[model samples]
Target: MKSGGNLEAVLNAGEFAITGELGPPRGTSIEAVREKAAHLKGMVDAVNITDNQTAVVRMASWATSLIVIEEGLEPNYQMVCRDRNRLAMQADILGASALGIRNILCLSGDHQQFGDHPRSKGVFDIDSIQLVNMVKNMRDEGKFLGGDDIDGPPKLFIGAAANPFGEPFEWRVHRLAKKLAAGADFVQTQCIYNMKKFRQWIDEANDMGLTEKIHILAGVTPFKSIGMARYMKNNVPGMDVPEDMIKRLKGAGKGKVATEGIKIACEQIEEFKEMKGVAGVHLMAIEWEHRVPQIVEQAKMLPRPVITPGSGEA
Candidate 1:
């Protein structure tokens, strides 16, 4: 076990795990965190706290994750390379560990052009791939990025993002391999609306035995309406929503789109559970945190598996 967090322990115990996300408020109130955490309290192994998702400047992920810990929930703190340089990234890793965070998702964040602060400059001192390897070294080798010794290093369950839907499809699986070689313990992909392509990508990964070495959580988001479906298909980058999916939502009409969306999500969850290489599902229900419990229960994922620490584990 890299960290004593329940997420690693659960996956290590060979059980299918569920993790949800929490997008913190734009301001400083912790009540939003409390309310959202309450909804996902017992339903998920961990709740991912996004760091300024889309670079819109929300509350810091590390600070919000502390509140999640207070709610008795494990946190998957996301850190993006666009906002912080190497020094800040290293400092945040140490700070997060001291505050009891174990899971960290390293990301090459979206450009500021899509964010509220379009005039701000980005600080991509290093890419996501390098960030993953750096975290691995900090945790396993007890050394800083500059090769300086540390009295004690942070224990982290490192993770990286993979966009199986992106272009040059031939290169996606190889990209996953690169991250694995860099020491990413797990990967969560972008929102999945086209399972055929996702399955193919995972198939290639399986052929390479990547699944045996790391946990791959298929990303899923419940579409709220036809407009949302169209937005993702036409506007969202790296999204591959098939025309049939859009037709399914459009066919639902205005009165029942959310209901239809939930059905589609449940169906995908069922399929993901049966996928050969998928170890879990990562639900990125943006601004829809309250719907998580109902979705999980309706999908028959209640009564989460029991995971206890094994030999030589704290």
Candidate 2:
């Protein structure tokens, strides 16, 4: 369910939500960024601009979020603490809200050393949980990090990340609980490839009485190639793919693997849509944005209502 104030309107109306990820350009030109935003404008509820995803250098998330707003698409802007201190982090949060971007996803970004930029220094001034608490304090208390009151406080829907398949599976539930305690309104999990693991994670969350506090969106990404799968497994922290899925993809012929990936993503989403704690599916189609609508439709998750003035409140 879209639990963010503005996003909730969409969920309350029975909208099967859609969100896209944009790796903002490292260079100045936003032509490519705008083009991607334009392509998903009416098709998605919002576009998430990843902040230095994979620890790779790229355009700043705040600027790209503003660009997405300018392109007429809502932005679920990503804020990672690996690159900024609490001071910068707080400023960006206020800045984004002032720019009219309502959704903020708190993340402890991947280390720069893990990404292509090994030479870049890593900054973990505050982990994702602290960032969540910071934003909540800012919005709820009407004060900045320094305890100074503002004329107009920022408003936003706070989100945090969860990885069920990460090492020590039980930690996922624990971390999620911590995030909720820190005032996370919603959670977008790491890309899920194994359903059993996801269910186990959800059950643990439910047992802790967390299922009701925050909206959980199952994250799914369609693999474009076997090589990419390997990259994800080897490089991405808090991500683990099963042997069976890799075997299946490996056995599939080159031309057929991507189709299998899409099919698997669709199946996973279909199942995730039915789970008890799940709010909805956040399809990270990545470069395959064009396939999202079809994937949702083929999975029988379409026919969403309009999220507008007349929709009743949840």
Candidate 3:
């Protein structure tokens, strides 16, 4: 298994780190995920396997991450505290480590009512911060909640999500600080559509010294149409696609709106590409994975110095 610290090493070796999210299928068939994995192979540093994303029933993240690993790609295994208690959460972390899934994204999942299954009860036995602490303990102390030593403690490159655009922005920053203090090695932010606000947040993070503490990957998603833009703005918590973007979508209309969105996303990426404290962009294309390579290429962020596996040492 690759060392869990490799992710931090890679991020530190360069000014930018690129990662993409892959939503696992809800069914038993592995064919769909396998196809997606094949397309993403060698194109990104890591592919995040979403865990019951949006509270919808889907393929468990651990299984999907294992599939990505078997496909010869780095898998960012997402672990959400909404569905599992401390026991299950710790067990799954160990299980993921055994499967060679080194990178983990800790999250407090979306409420069940927001998902397709409204009647399903939510199990937020552990919040996001506590989950981070759990993983930190498992990594540092090599013991579970009961203080019993396992065969071996899991080594995980822990990633936590942040929403700079969410409500009570002060609370957002405070929580991010808490997560980092709890041992999050890196942070992947929510979709950022407003460059001005994004810059402001980056400034704040830099002032708080997070810029030096952990790799911060700014999230960007391409809007397919005006409908999508509206839906995301209205529905997705911690996301806000501005009116100008929606106007752009309306002006571009059906055929080329996605291309327009791509341009916008690329522009956002380019704007942050050379910034001193910004680490890199985390592209979340949802089902539009095929467009990522083009976005990267068009942004002229390509031809980055390749740090082949073992070259990330300090």
Highest TM-score: which candidate?
1
Q: Give the count of colliding residue pairs in each prediction.
A: 0, 1, 0
TM-score of each: 0.98, 0.92, 0.94
Q: Per-residue alpha-carbon lDDT of model 3 for 66-165, expressed as tens digits?
A: 8888787788999887788888998898998987888999999888887889888788898998888888888888878778887888988888999999
lDDT of 1 by residue, 1-314 (tens): 79888889888877788899999999999998899999999999888999999989999999999999999999999999999999999999999998899999999999988999998989999999999999999999998999998678998899899999898999999999999999999999999989999999999999999999999999999999888998999999999999999899888887999999999999999999999999999998888988999999988888777575674253
Window of ten residues with lowest summed lDDT in model 2 = 1-10
lDDT of 2 by residue, 1-314 (tens): 22244455665555555566777887888898887776666666677889988788888999998998889878888999888887888878778888788889999887787788788777888789988988888888888777888667778888898988977876879989999999898788889887788899999888888978888888989998898888888877678788888888888887999888888887887787778888777778787767766776776765544566656465
Give the local distance difference test score of model 2: 0.80
Whole-model lDDT per candidate = 0.92, 0.80, 0.82
